[model samples]
Target: MLSRCSMLPSSSDVQSLQGLSGIRHLAESRRFKAWFLDQFGVLHDGKQPYPGAISTLEKLASNGAKMVIISNSSRRASTTMEKMKHLGFDPSLFVGTITSGELTYQYLKRRDDAWFAALGTSCIHMTWSDRGAISLEGLGLKVVENVVEAEFILAHGTEALGQASGSVRPMKLEDLEQILEQCAAKRIPMVVANPDFVTVEARALRIMPGTLASQYEKLGGEVKWMGKPGKIIYEAAMKMADADASDSIAVGDSLHHDIKGANAVGIQSAFITCGIHASELGLDSFAEVADISRVVALASKYSSCPSYVLPAFTW
Candidate 1:
């Protein structure tokens, strides 16, 4: 269980709830006009779409609720959309997607902000594959193979480094200490494209960019995170949905990313326990309703009190 200190900043106005019933509860209650849905555990498990995910999306769409699929994926929005289509999701179901990769790319491409403008053109690109580097093209940025010759570090996460070593497991601190040490010595700023510590992929949780970025910050390296738990992404999502905070609710499986982020932005949140915390909460199946006390305890542990709790995203 995650301690309170580990959770992201939350809003003081939103009090703790007893438990969540189901997605239909929110719809029936007419509590929100727009829904920001998470893509990973809530919609699919990486390999395929969840059993009722498509239909649930259809139901929400028919209800005239604005839907935006939010993701902490390191891939660009277009890439993410392509993958979602391949996985059998209807593109017309949601208004648009806001991915970490897309946000990072937009920031770099426009350089409208002070932080992004200060960044140099040459960077050491770190990713699982060359496809990850595709986001940097047409932005006048150069990708260098070596950290020593780079002006900044573009890190997707440690997963790529682990894969390069022929390991299917998540990368640990020891696996990245050497590279992190070099960047730290140079005081190089790192652009973390994805800000999720762990993501569910086919029932298996894997470490993501946020984990490595946290370690890098601990080692005295400057890091810029572009995804959830940060206010920027939430603001971007709200703008895309064109909804006010009071009428918007964020639904996701991770407390650290989804619930905490929603609270941070003063938007209502629904905690879906069947995704990443299923085993920890003793839930044997996605359809199994979690004990109210267990759900309350989990929320208390994270110091984030979501407005509702549900076993899964179903109508």
Candidate 2:
């Protein structure tokens, strides 16, 4: 483990970077080599690719840069790959991809004991609205849409909860309580595939998998979060990359998840400030707009400083 002090660069060190002008030149210089791009904000918002996203990717891909798509998405890797192609990203551009769901399944199935030995005889999965995208049952895991039908339950965020149902969505606090009651009585454990509280949708905020997981815990149900900010996920990412902590770069938007995850492994990071709360940027001299360095300095105070910062993925 890297000592906290060793990972931090003092204010003078940051001042030496020469700011946005230097960043632009560095990006344009074609020296950074490879890119590990995220899906939600950097490339697409659900079904639509953000403007300039395609061209920006094309620019990077054309320059002989190796690209990897790393996401905390609940969708299986194949489904995410299809979405990438649909969003105008050439599938050929990326060499490898990893998702939280894949990691969750692998983590469970490979344990010395059969997965979910603690959860009784059977397990049920409660996935997001994109149900057809993944099938845990193939691995001998049972799948159920409702928690009442489950001996054990696993949940990611619900898309329907954010849309037409709005507050009426089934993952509400009351419904969660009912599920927790059932599980507690039966003594079942819940595994949460993605544990982020909220993710940015362009400028708007939407619920993430962690919200449900945390709620489950409050009800005295055992809940395990399976993604970044959680050690398992970052370790899995490093294993996939076959990378040493000092040789990798983790580019993400959330300070709590992305920045902290990378820092935990001694991997460097590039923070994306456009996501979550941009209003706070103005408080830091519009650091959100000009460059990523300010965000790095700001994170340093909180013990989660990133190695570098970048705007949301734009050319």
Q: Per-residue lDDT of 77-189 in model 1, one digit per residue for the tens? A: 88899999999999988889999989998899999999999998887666663223334557787776466777887777554442222333334546566777788899989
- Which RMSD does model 2 reach against the true structure? 5.1
Q: Given candidate 1, what's the lDDT at residue 168? A: 30
Cα deviation of 126, candidate 2, in Å = 3.0
Consecutive 10-residue window with the lowest summed lDDT within model 1: 162-171
lDDT of 2: 0.60
Q: What is the per-residue lDDT of model 2 for residues 1-315, given as tens digits with 9 covering 90 to 100?
A: 462434565544332232333333435653455455567755666657766667766766676555667778776678789878877778877767777777676666765555555554345444455433244544555554454656677665544222211122334545555655666676568777777777766556677767777777776778877777666666665666566565455667676777777767666566666555354454232223644456555666555765555555555
Best by TM-score: 1
Candidate 2 lDDT at 133 equals 27
List runs of model 1 lying over 4 Å from the truth. Answer: 1-21, 130-135, 161-174
Residue 190 in candidate 1, Cα distance off native in Å: 1.1
